[model samples]
Target chain A: MSPVSTSASRLVYDALKSCGVRLMSALPETWLVHLIGLAEADPDMTLVRLAKEEEGVGISAGAHLAGVKSAMLMQNHGFLASINGIVSCAQLYRIPLLMLVSYRGEFGERDPWQTEGGGVTEDLLRALRIPFARLENPSHVSHRIAKAQTLAHSANKPVALLLCRDLMWEEQT
Target chain B: MRRLDALRAVYSQLEGRIVVTIMGAVAAELQSIGHRPNFFYLQHAMGLASSLGLGIALSRPDRQVVVFDGDGSVLMNLGGLTTLARYRPRNLVHVVFDNESLLSVGGFPTATSTGSDLAGIAAAAGVPRTQTVRSIDEFTHAFDEALAAEDLTTLVAKVEPVGPSAYVTDLSLLENRFQFQRYLKESRTTR
Candidate 1:
């Protein structure tokens, strides 16, 4: 992990904590490794490591039902994989779900395997009518996350904050 | 044994516990028995009730969370079993009704129809406790024990492939969500 990436991860983690996110569900992915690590180390936060991304949807719903704020951290592919739960469970049940998706396969993509899912990430989010915002600049991280969370709670629907490479990765210098 | 009978045998035991039922037959049948504020019928989303229960269990360790799931739904998200095992919330009781078919959406046979052992799979997934019961007596006993214990337990109840006459419930999805959420909040305050 680059120093800048680790710093960015801390900024995002702090922002989530500030929003009163007590629980988080995630599966191991490159961009989210540090964020997951931070969650694991925090005794105040409960980290539910998921076998698949879709399970996080249900986890977040259950958390909301229990009157606890929670978040989901996953790669863009994970967001795509979780469409069923996002639509049927979160949307149908009117649960506010805050998902921080690691945006891969955009503009400067390395791995060919990621491009397919990344390519369709925005289109699918639009199709689902799931409101989303991009988080690329470090300075905008806290404000963007807080606003996304507020929208999710107010609308009682699934909202996404895409963690772009600019925010998640620092050029290897 | 029939699914309704299995549910009925354990109905009284579910009084104070938070219950989450999967979509379709399980939800419909549970509703037929009677409705409770603590019950959340996860309507459209199949195969994620266990995950939901896990979240509730973890969030409210003071409350017991029980998930009523189906074989088809379980098979749809087998990875959930492993995730449940990973967390191992002591307050969670996962009860899978294996009817060997998707009784809600026509009579399409599921993987369990051939020879998939859900209990065996759950044990392999590292859930603290697991059991498979074929008779109502066995199911009731296992359920009672699971509720009594503080370990995460997965009970697979084998039942006949039969469902209620209708799958519709009078409760809307949003209504159920609010009712359940309100129940959780009130329960917390009273405690």
Candidate 2:
């Protein structure tokens, strides 16, 4: 029995690949563990393990400059931490950045520390003017990811897809 | 050595390489020398120049990526050093101009002012090659070697805490980005 939501993780990873995301930068988090593992094992992909989340912003921007499609994978807390980079670098420079954020600490969240960040995630995204969508249903994962990536590139702005608990949790019965 | 003089010493060597300079004196001074399509002056990003360079290096393995950073910016994101070492792109060169102060913002001292050895830190962080130079000759030598070698290198140059008089540039952020992307695309096709 695996701890991660294996089927959902595969769905998200395949969607990213279909969207031509060859490079991914991430910092370790529980919800993103399986996705990160999949990225690491894929030889065709480049996985940059960042020490902090904001670094991924710069990495994605650089990849954009070099004509490589890239994405950033992190938790909601990481998204909050990376707001500075997102605003100052990505937005100011108009880089097309795709961010896949694990929406932790919403409903059914047991961790007290994660709740504050989760609570403010959508509000902050709104404040920043970064359009985002929630991936709560497994059936909507692929289309949402593809749409978000297209929006990012077409609009030349930072767009996010929030991976909700319903789409990223596996219940053991 | 003066920052501008050191830049002049190696300006020609940067002809074909992709250069990413942090926001401040380094970008202004480099632009004053000459602006090229391959040069991306990261205007507002203070501490992510190295990360940007790493991305370009990893994405375009055929091209060499050089980052011009400052003491304050590098100190702000020391974790960047560890990340660079972890991947260790062969075509990446990180050059930190250790003026020991945030010269562009104000004459405030940074961690390097009290003897934080950036080259030593990078070496400890597992970067394959690292060097510290104080003179223009040494800087040029180390930079030339770093660019020529097939391994990741971090070169920290100690200099006086001084910068250009003004921080203005005519190039807009969007314009620079498009020009850079176009340059990369054209160069790839030409090669």
Candidate 3:
């Protein structure tokens, strides 16, 4: 529940804006609450506090169909919850969606529940045939997000920008 | 009233507005009634028609968005209702075809069949407006009010359980999606 730095949120927001993301449907991460706050405060972006990650996928896909570029911000568990909707709606329809997923189980010692999701995240993404790039270092934040958005928009597929443990929370065990 | 009659009644009122229909017989019936470029027929996705409609409505505030959903699909993603209510897009109109059974999947009873009030659930979930219409006249009045108003509304149309509907679509899902987007673009330009 520690407050992640505002800088990380700012960097991601700038990158997403650069990619022409106007609507964001997010399932809040405790470490990324400030990111949601940033999206909410910005007048250019319509922030939807989604009930679940699957709902965000559907909403983002719908927004894309209407010519509005949209993104989803959530943790790995939410990503897992969104698999069916993302695959069925986004993948089947070929709508580009930028998913900013905070990696919960990647690296360092963590909770039991998070361990499984962290371990299986990459495999799950591959199983769904979704292209993804992991951002383990803060330095790659801007370029990686921009690249992910470009690939998603150009290919009309859901691409992932995985924010690993260090980039998510400031303090690590 | 029969599901077909209920759908026909609503379809006449939609005009040029954007429509997203649930999968199975509901979508089949919608296609059978008449096809429009503005209408989106979800082929495989069970519960995301409303979510898609909400997204488009939010993105295109100037355009009215309508969702034609079924009870089984609504039960699958009640959270869509909460999300819709939370965002409260004024241009969104959600109408659920409540046959109380999974008529799309062989008429197995859904929770609604055993007495779950979807309108009450939607209202409890925070949608500004909610109504349940049993007759054609009731549905017409309720839908007209919803279409004319700015607040988000949900109408649960109770219809009799029916057998499998067998209307096949001439176009594919991708074609429908592309055409619908083009229609939205045209709508924006004409506006």
Candidate 4:
């Protein structure tokens, strides 16, 4: 039997396309690996992998300024590194920046390092004052993604869509 | 003519436009000269300036966006040209400062040494209008004309090799960041 498609990925892709997102700056991580694949498969979307998390934010900010809709995909840990770019460039310029973040340590995650990032992910975003949504079901993905995009666009600010690992991978096993 | 002169010419002609500057000395200069809050300094991203500009332009179609690009940065992601061509933003102006070397990260030769025609490449990549300027006067004319044109345009300015100016104010990374956060907050509350 074929694997069940993750509607989350489709919703994200559609939100990206509908909003005319042309580029995505990302890093390889398990949580967002699927979104990266979808971005690669779509010709309309250009996937830009950065050497560092900070670079991802800067690149996305620049792309957004040049008339391309872009998203910065990274883990919560990486989000810390991107704060400078997000605040200095994106927020300062009133550039719309969408962050697709993975909740690292949620669901009794075994990795110690991941737990550190996961523990502070929500608070970190809160500290940054970037409103976010914890994505639970694929059904709600489209509306939430759209809402985040609208908030970012209208406010020229950054918004996060946090995806917990358990919510996405729990049923697979 | 100085790099600032070329930039000033472009800036003077553009009214209420968002200009995105990539990391490096060029960005600092533009920002120092009173660029709008929409001015994005790529700080460390190197080459993705045009792509970022593309995103902003697409999202806010009502705003005219210009990307101040460096030759080294452009070469790093030449493939981005194809993406730009594909989308073809009408209000997008891609101004490439072709100094023939990576002046920002120490002077290093670029792909242009092997006869990389940046303008030709941009044309092939699908930018509707691609022009090259060798001097400040020429650039000023071209810059003004590009603003008037209603299509995706790429203007390559073969600027003289110059480093960052000495009189510029150096805003710490953290400080600039706070400024931006404040910008978002202020704008949000006002709106």
Candidate 5:
């Protein structure tokens, strides 16, 4: 009956816990609001709401160093904004961080501003030499999240799991 | 007061604490004073020293972590202040070297030179204790108080932007991180 008990949030939360992500940082994205709420209500996860996504990157780098597996949940626009922090801190230092990004400005996007960010999301991650996977539906969430976590830990670097529009959007009725 | 002078005094008062130094004069000065595994110097990651320290402080609540920062570095990420306030790690000390210039980057004047008050910013950002000091004596006193406190403290020390002798150090970045982690790990084992 609750908003977050839906298929998408359940799979993501279950995957995050099983992957050993103890801390999470997020900024608001309309599609992610429900998932963010789910994380807030979780007792096992220490969730931090960030003013900017870059701070989440920096904080996650530190948290990773301190032996806590950390993840950053942000919108695609926020991911671009966090490029410098991600490159200079996480990539340069070889700090492992799992980024859970909401894919904005997709085919049905209503905002013009989101087009550029969403269009270049995968390209930017690729340019940065960060490995990533697309999370398109309910079945893809757990496998992709686990793979991203494994890649981050083994390579001592960051990886991205982009939550696609299909899995998040629902009938407006 | 000069930054080097302040560092010498501040370095003397430090004990049983892990230090994280941002790039430039702060890291160079800390290195010139003494090199130890307890000191972690971050290079090329401006505005991240405090965030890194916050992570370690939260992870190892038993140990104190001090960050040697600069005006340029802190301004690069003021949002870190809000995060620090939110986390409120008691064993964290943020010491800002406010010389009002990006001293490491060809001395371009920063907002602090025009009129940016970092101490007021920190206090406004909800840091428990924020102090701005201008003299060597004042800095030593403020830093001492910060080290002794059990809550988050931010000290902004105003000084002349002059580090004529700031140069490269002979330390290894990877080695420093390994040693720092090793020290923390060993400490945990013994406890």
Candidate 6:
């Protein structure tokens, strides 16, 4: 059998579709340029751009409450800013939402700013009490995205999927 | 009256109430008083606490919802109050602790210290009822009265800046989110 065809962006959008997510709040990150391109092209999808990460969470929560499944996408560093919104609003109001976080700095990564984010990624999630899974490869992206969706909708709580730095930035042409 | 005392009284007296605590010292205080599973603390994000509470109150119209927000946090998203007032969730009770500073990060003064009246802002934004309270007795009485009214209410508690009572850095964020997810699932089955 031929290998499954996918990219990090494809994995995310496909799973979001399967989960019935109607509104997707995102920031303009390099990782999501392609995903945004897809969203911009899709007629059924609604992508809302936020000025800040915290605002994305609030918007997603609002959209979810208004009878639409939603997700918030942001960078790893953005987590610190958005944590309060996640805990206070999403967790408190029991909004079933998914957050897609692009892992910035990981072991063997080159970006100087990302090093700090890669270092504390797990601790941050653990401290915020958000269940998350780190995707290691592009092939497994779809499955992990699906799991994030399942956890979000089934539990009616926020769930995150941390897309590893290499997986998001590496090109596969 | 202390902010803690007022919060404890509110929590104890109110049953089946969904309370959303905003980020800052208020949340830490609420947790220190033997956190009820129903209380959701923002941990670090300020201001948006009321927006979340509005979602809950509107979502579950049958349940009464309360938001314990700090003055600094409220100012961060002051626009939210106007939005909240426009939507008007009748069962929502918003109580702001006006310590006049970013007490949680450090005792830095806020615009409220320089005469920014958030309660007045809330009233001007069309909140049906708004009041300022300085003592515990006042808080309890006002809160009771506010809840009784069939409209969205805002209570500004004139509190002094408080230091963290619990320096707890060990509580699990992942576990909290997971447990809350479980709670929502359970709540659905019950509904």
Interface RMSD of 1: 0.6
Which CAPRI level is candidate 6? incorrect
lDDT of 3: 0.86
**Model 3: pairs clashing at backbone N, Cα or C within 3 Å:** none
Question: How do the residues A122-153 of candidate 6 rate in per-residue lDDT, one tens digit apiece?
Answer: 89888877889987677777778788888887
Residues B103-140, candidate 2: write the lDDT tens digits: 87788898888988999999999999999999999999
Candidate 1, DockQ score (0 to 1): 0.87
Native-to-model Cα distance after best TM-score fit, residue A132 in candidate 5, in Å:
0.1
Per-residue lDDT for A85-140 in model 1, tens only?
99999998889999999999997778899888888999999999999999999999
Error of 5 at B70 (Å): 0.8
| lDDT by residue for model 4 (A16-55), tens | 7776678887877776767788888887777876555666
Q: What DockQ score does model 4 reach against the true complex?
A: 0.18
- Tell me what TM-score chain B of candidate 2 gets against the true chain B: 0.98
Clash counts per candidate, in order, are 0, 0, 0, 22, 0, 8
Please report, as a value between 0 and 1, the fraction of native contacts recovered by candidate 2: 0.79
lDDT of each: 0.92, 0.92, 0.86, 0.73, 0.84, 0.73
Which residues of candidate 1, in runs, are more than 4 Å off? A1-4
The DockQ scores of all candidates, in the order shown, are 0.87, 0.87, 0.80, 0.18, 0.59, 0.12
DockQ-based ranking, best first?
1, 2, 3, 5, 4, 6
Query: What does candidate 1's lDDT look like per residue over B56-132, in tens digits?
Result: 99899999999999898999899999999998999999999999998877898999889999999999999999999
Model 1: clashing residue pairs?
none
TM-score of each: 0.98, 0.98, 0.96, 0.61, 0.94, 0.61
Q: Is the docking of candidate 1 incorrect, acceptable, medium or high quality?
A: high
Greater DockQ among 2 and 3 belongs to: 2
Is 1 or 4 the stronger prediction by lDDT? 1
In the range B32-132, model 6's lDDT, one tens digit per residue, is 77766556665655677776676555555666778888888888887678767876889889999898887766688999999999899999988889999
Report residue A134 deviation for candidate 3 (angstroms). 0.6
